[model samples]
Target: MQFSGFFSAAMMMIVLSPSLQSFPPAEAIRSSHLDSYIRLPSFQVSTSPDSQDDRFSFRKAFEFRNANECGFADHETTGVCDPTLVHVAITLDVQYLRGSIAAVHSILQHSLCPENVFFHFLVSETDMETLVRSTFPQLKFKVYYFDPEIVRNLISSSVRQALEQPLNYARNYLADLLEPCVRRVIYLDSDLVFVDNISKLWSTNLRSRTIGAPEYCHANFTKYFTNSFWSDDRFSGTFRGRKPCYFNTGVMVIDLVRWRRAGFTRRIE
Candidate 1:
């Protein structure tokens, strides 16, 4: 499976191609019950005295009925070990909460087996969980808190302040954060909205590769490094025998089993 997206300063539109492998027909969730499954909860945020009054606000609920053209595991019986369940991981924070909600809505709207798709949300704050639950009442998801101290020292200064956030590097530790039963997962950025079934991307064959993404070999890779890095043979020689290419980390399919076995998280740090 391949996804193409055009990037610019303002907006980006991504078009994804379907997979060759076909799946069995799915039973659609009745439209009549859609309201019950997606009712947004009314709740109050517990804020400190000094916190802003508008620190947390309500979000409108969204419901998407499956077209029932594809097969899916029974939501009642499908556990984390179920092979049919499509696992997806995403990071959530105050800055991108709105975009994340829209992204989830887009995914459910386009997925053939919306019931079988489970979300693993990585978050730094605990309050976001209540907000997510209220927004998507029937969503099958779990939240994991990422400790900022783990990567505080490893993170280098970046040009953008947002890039310096600890949550930005949470994806690097998915191998450790997720359960052992989860063999693979699709990691998506909060900004993107899926126009096609993500199951196609889930069915992708990684072959011997532990990770798969759109590679950009045409870009000038040297600009990513400092002049001193190129001057030192020790740093520049890391790519000696390989043809390396830059790939966006925002959207990727990662083989967690291979990642764990290889100790990739530690190596990245």
Candidate 2:
């Protein structure tokens, strides 16, 4: 299960490769969706004074992970994990996007949502709306942006802090500002593209644990977590007590509400 921090930025998908259909440009797609959606320069977290508490539980959320150890052939879910209407949430820092513009456009096209699903893209304030609008305007996905100060609070402030929780940096606000109903949020990076349908990746459960994902538990798995995450008694205890089921964060389906309930975030934070 050699999934590193890079995979978070790389593997936002799980489907197999396409037959190379000539999909329209992302800009064109954005135009189609926004024509119906409220037009805006950028997206930001919306709040309402009338907001009510809508907490979550282990009953509502699930976790999934991607691992190179098993490769594509062995990556299929077992019999217990075959469900429909599964939802997934992915978080990306558009600033981390690299490679050619065409590559980024291609990755956005792979979002495996026919209808009624979420693929959350968390971009920077300085980034232009045109960057994404022109890139992936077709998918009716939600994109949000935060000012530098807010982003500072939402993501790690530095590399040193990031090493403490490589995957945690992008989700800095999960422990704080996440909506009360947000029981689980699957944190995903934007670097990789999907080969298989995302629903296939979302159908599984995490069993009784509040968190579940394929462990990057091998010796190599150590790179993604901060010394703090690796040193936590729960993680270490789980490591020694169980079969070393380390997890890669790329395709994680999390239960934020449950994690908060069990003080799981407090444990890692």
Candidate 3:
């Protein structure tokens, strides 16, 4: 079941970002109106022409359309902030490109509203957008470059070398990396497939929580920390009044609105 070699080898996550105050009246988010709400400087993706030497290639997937009940007709528009749109984010890297493609294909193949799903790909490498475009053909997606330097020093050695990649930490900065209008996002690891409709997962009611994911309260979470961390009451005692369960960041429903209001990016750092 392992898609790639890393801990908890097979898993999925969805994240939903909630609003801090009142939600916006309009359901649609247009790129033109972003200037008023954009708080972070936009990151750049490489525009170099696709090279023949590029290491990966994928066959074009059949275009999937929305079912009649969905009532979605905005496919002509390229807006990423559409409330009806399901925002799913995944990190893209050459090391796991195969898994990433398979995940996307599975989502599209099983989704009830395939066209309504928008992908927000986070990456440290360049020229991947081109590859994705060629493969999906009619896929709705945008690529955002995650500067490795932003999290380079913050990352430390891990049990697996793949865990050491700076892009592995890109999920922490997603609230800042995505458009301010993207309030909710499903952050997925590029290593799993969806056999059921993703909309079912998207419709999960997070209620007042910032993020939602499968919780394993029975797991020995303490083993994740170091001896010094366990010895220090300041660090260990932070969980004293709470029941923290082991949750995979890979599959999460993140409320970006709640994340931005709480300054989660800075908190994670």
lDDT of 3 by residue, 1-269 (tens): 11222322233332112551242211111122232243222322222237333333456677898899989567566498788899999988765665677789889999988999999999898778877887788999999999999887877532234456799899998898999989899988875677778887787678888888765556454655566766788877877867776676778889889989999889889
Model 2 TM-score (2 dp) = 0.47
Q: How do all the candidates rank in terms of lDDT, highest first?
A: 3, 1, 2
Candidate 2 wrongly placed segments (more than 4 Å): 1-88, 91-95, 99-112, 124-129, 145-168, 175-178, 221-245
Best by TM-score: 1
- The residue-by-residue lDDT of candidate 2 on 1-269, one tens digit each, is 23355434344433222532354222122112222143333333212225332211111111223334422322123211222223344443322332122223333344344332334555444343445444454433445553345334444332343343333344544534444644556555433355445544454465666655554544444543567766677754645645545465544667666677777545654
Give Cα-based local distance difference scores for all models: 0.71, 0.41, 0.71
* Winning candidate number (lDDT): 3
Clashes of 1: 1
Better model by lDDT, 2 or 3?
3
Error of 2 at 142 (Å): 3.2
